[model samples]
Target: MSQPLTGVKVLDFSTLLPGPLCSLLLAEAGAEVIKFERPGQGDEMRSYEPKVDDDSANFVLLNRGKLSVAIDLKSPEALSQLLPLIREADVLIEQFRPGVMDRLGLGYAALAEVNPRLVYCSITGFGQHGPRASEAAHDLNYVAASGMLSLTAGNDGAPVLPPALIADIAGGTYPAMINILLALRQRDQTGRGVHLDVAMADNLFTFQYWGLGNGALGDWPAPASGLVTGGTPRYQVYRTADGAFLAAAPLEDKFWDNFVALVGQDANALAKMSPHRAIEAVAAAIALHPVAYWEDRFAGQDVCTSRVVSLEEARHEPHFQARGLFDRSVTTAAGGTLPALPVPVDAAFRRPDRSAASPALGAHNQLLNR
Candidate 1:
């Protein structure tokens, strides 16, 4: 199979999650991603916990199939060495605060002068020029700023921390990848690159399209009061006898009826009860059975009810295995291997290799000497 990004070259200066993941997708599609890291420490994520050999598991996973070059950008001779690569690079990704790159003489304008067709992408928390651009924040702060956290409330009405870095991946990485592709497309026609400003917080509003619509009509949803949040009995979580939870989302009348029948509850009575009362009744009924019992009862039923499974359980699920989501693996130099982090790229667009290893720190620093 032919990968889409066969000859494309990427200069990855971003650390942590968003930019690294975006480039990982590109690398999977056959791009040559050359990562620039600080000489000694490399990307900060390399020091993160759960080491596989010398690098962190996260670093190993994200930097897979990429080349690494270690150099001190602050050194006077840095730009001279980078200019050769920059002049030929098709893309560059950075996640520094707005002016940090400019100060380091590696901003879009500086690099564009060298390679007019370079797709320079900057991923930031707020944005390049927003009021909060220079302010420090993380994934949680971005979601909170976007009002997404406000919708994720528990029974006590306090916002719960999200399980994953929603803002980092959903808001930053995906958008950066999309826009970089778009910018590359534009370059194909225009013969000139464009600066892409990807603000994680700004992009988060798209995830709240429904909430935005409600807010526009002055019917803004309060904490856990929205349909998908925790509003109706048809869309809530119920705990089982063994302290496990079931995610129930039989919203339509047909599915609700099926769920009611399967749970041995009166559909009409549930419809008559207050939303809170209905939720309580459903919870009480579910509490009568263990997760396995409910899982068996809901099997092959269109009630849209399922037990909340653990990560390990989900990874070992037969459906995902059948789909070959974990068929590919990331191997370490020491020969330890784990399932590659599943990416959104289609199978036809990805490399066919079943296993690949992430680069050791400065493993490809020889490229810089060229």
Candidate 2:
């Protein structure tokens, strides 16, 4: 496909979501992604939720547009084949624990000897230097440790995990992509590669911008109490008559006033009412109408109120569709096409980025030699 990364090569030693997802983006943009796997067992995500003929949708979705290389990292013959391939790689990403790669003699320092221009990326729970870097954790664990978990609430009224893999995919993928790009830019100037030690926990901490700021000011020390959290009634979710949902996030006074007016309530009273009372009023009023009734009433009002759409509904959202969010397609290893989600890129960045199919298991055994 036509893409800016057409000539780029990526060695992905990561499994599951984050690392796979990072390479998937590069591969989509025409980079040749080589996914390394164990001899028999592959990425655990292959059997995770939503199986289609024993292949996980999660795996299929993130792993398209890459080639797979399966070999036992412990085998001398396999190691031999891998070294030469590593020598020619532009970027190398690994999600193993801090010492795993080093034990296998495939660490950043060792690999860089063969390819001085290789960008080596290491993904872990905490970091290469932190005390908790050795701990084993999942998305929720990382979220909890990073303080982002306190920002979320559950139906049971306790801090809970978000439905998505926010820590792994968002934090890890964002760190990988951004640093890789930065390293690529630096390579142009220095003619050498760099190592990126991306701690998923630290990366996930970026979500706590306002809370962190609050802490620095010695105010709002409690989590979820800051302006951007659940502190303002203007930024809360209200229910509709049919038990559907509506969200109002107009933190500004003007939009908050408009939201109250749209609900046929006393705008001034709402602003003055106790948070509990105001939330109750908004909730009660919203329960008086079906989603459609309020949707029409609020239409063209430029209010921040909106229906809380589901994933399926979001897939068909007119706004996103019109904006070409999911406009492109990615070719699959099975010679098929699937919807490609458009990433946010600068409008001034004029580069052709396209999607290709994810690599099948061990699909590139012969293409890359060690």
Candidate 3:
């Protein structure tokens, strides 16, 4: 079957996680993604650690099946070099600071004049014209600014650092992809493209919808006091006897009943007790058994409980293996191959052969002269 975006062309002027990940998804959907990098250095992620084949594994993972074109966007003749690609591109994505593209003469206004049907997406820490638009921030800073960090408190009452780049991937990459796809559909009807200003911090408010709803009703709970945010014993992480953790989230009465029975608790008593005290009691019970014990005990039960496994364990999980989630592999520049990181695109839309590796810096420079 032909991929959905078989003929679409993408001009990617982004770096690191958010923009690269967004373009990765587009590439999986069969868009011809051409990553436009700097003259010598490419995406900063190319220099990140855990190298495979002398290039950063992080870069290869996110940039598989994409072409690379190197050009000094800061040069006097930069626009001339980029005009050909822009004129033929259906989408253009950039992650620069608010005014950087405008100053480079590659802003949406300039590029849209050349290809008015282009869907221009700008992914940033903040929106194009906000007070914090030009502020420098990483994933943690954006989550902090979005109030997501405040809600992830540890047992010591301090906010714990997130294990993943939630703000970058969720706030920026996912939103950029969604908006770009929507804009593309809109373009088919109107024959005109749209500009997407995706602000990572701004998009994070949706993750706090429950808190926002409470705040709107003037009944906002304190940090970590909501049901899903560790307020209730019924939906929280508990430490096991072996120091490993079990994520328990028996939110419904039926599941809570199963969990209470499995843990030797009185469901009625737990239901009536204060939430904090109940949490303590549940934690104590959970601590009586090791993680493996609970994992086996909850195997077929509908209690919504499971052992907290590391990434390595997760990669080898039976459920994920059955789903064939990690079946795709991308080759490296040095002929080594690694598992291609899974994106949300459907398998039917993805390229069947995943042998494509990330391109070398400016690997497609000949396209510029053409």
Candidate 4:
């Protein structure tokens, strides 16, 4: 749909998950996001597992609504094309190590000379001038470095690896998108460009605001012993009889009462018991029912509970479909259709456009420089 950010051009000089995701958010909001990749391989994700020739599943999810413009940055002729385009761009996003962009002479300073109003953003594992700015790390490593790993664990169990990339998405992708949007707003008023140095590792700390707040207020060993971690039974996950799970996070007294009242859980589980025992009680109560039974009971209730859904099952979930979450079309290479995620916008305000399918490497070379 042609929504807000319509006609806004984004020069995406980023690759992999976080960078691509940042551009995807802009595209979803109706920007012309042109993705620049290495000359041949394009995004490394294009060849990541779950492939069909060049269409890797990971690539499709991240690269949707984006046009691929492959160019060799090391080549002067290829790099020169950015001069004209950056002049026209409203925003430019890139994910690279600190000095890499500077070496290519395509860094924020270089581009600002040609396009003063360009919003240049760089997403990195560390920020542009940090001690670890040039350190090599992936999502897992970023989380570990940020101390997020230390806080993840069951009672006396091993530290658990989260199923998703929180640092990359929550830290890198989310912040970069927001920074660009903020920069865009500022550019509208100030008519000046800005540089955003976003670090995925830094995001891990930000995502732990609740925990960090608790640590600041309550002090040390008691931090995880406070509101969010394993502190209250009202905010925890419990496994059901049939091996499914439900999340219950009713923080306020009224809501917590509603949660435990439904399952007849011990009242002491709420205010006084040690965190471990409190969680155990909640788990015990939830373990008595099949997920379907609780799913029915929790249906119209405000207990802060929901069934933990799988990726595949979630794709077919009726609630999302009812809410029109997947409202766009994804055309397969042979022209078949799959539901593409529409995005967050009011139906009346969102403009409809036939979004062209994502391109192969160097697919839109002729149009890239414009």
lDDT of every model, 2 decimals: 0.92, 0.78, 0.90, 0.79
What TM-scores do the predictions have? 0.97, 0.91, 0.98, 0.90
Q: What does candidate 2's lDDT look like per residue over 1-370, in tens digits?
A: 2566778899999998788888877776667888888766678887687764445667777876568888888886766778777877899999998898888888888888888999998877788887887888988899888878766753455886588888887778888888998999999999999999988888876777767777788864343345665656677777888888888887887887787777888977876887767777888888999999988999898788888998999888888789777756655566656676455553233135445555667777886553
Q: Candidate 4 — which pairs collide?
A: 2-351
State residue 116's C-alpha deviation in candidate 2, in Å: 1.5
Ranked by TM-score from best down, the candidates are 3, 1, 2, 4
Taking all chains together, the TM-score of candidate 1 against the true structure is 0.97
Query: lDDT, candidate 4, residue 56?
Result: 77
Q: What is the lDDT of residue 238 in candidate 2?
A: 76
Model 4: per-residue lDDT, tens digit, 1-370? 3478898999998888888888877886788999988887788888888764457767776777678787888887866777778888888888888888888888888889898999999899888986788888899898888777766766675678889989888899888888888998999899998999898888778777866776787664332465676677877778999999898898887888888888887576445777777777788888998999998987887798988998989888998879777767655454544566554445654446544365677778887545
Q: What is the C-alpha RMSD of each candidate to the true structure, in Å?
A: 1.2, 2.6, 1.1, 2.6
Among the numbered candidates, top lDDT falls to 1
Off by over 4 Å in 1: none
Winner by lDDT between candidate 4 and candidate 3: 3
TM-score computed on alpha carbons, candidate 3: 0.98
Cα error of candidate 3 at position 81, Å? 1.4
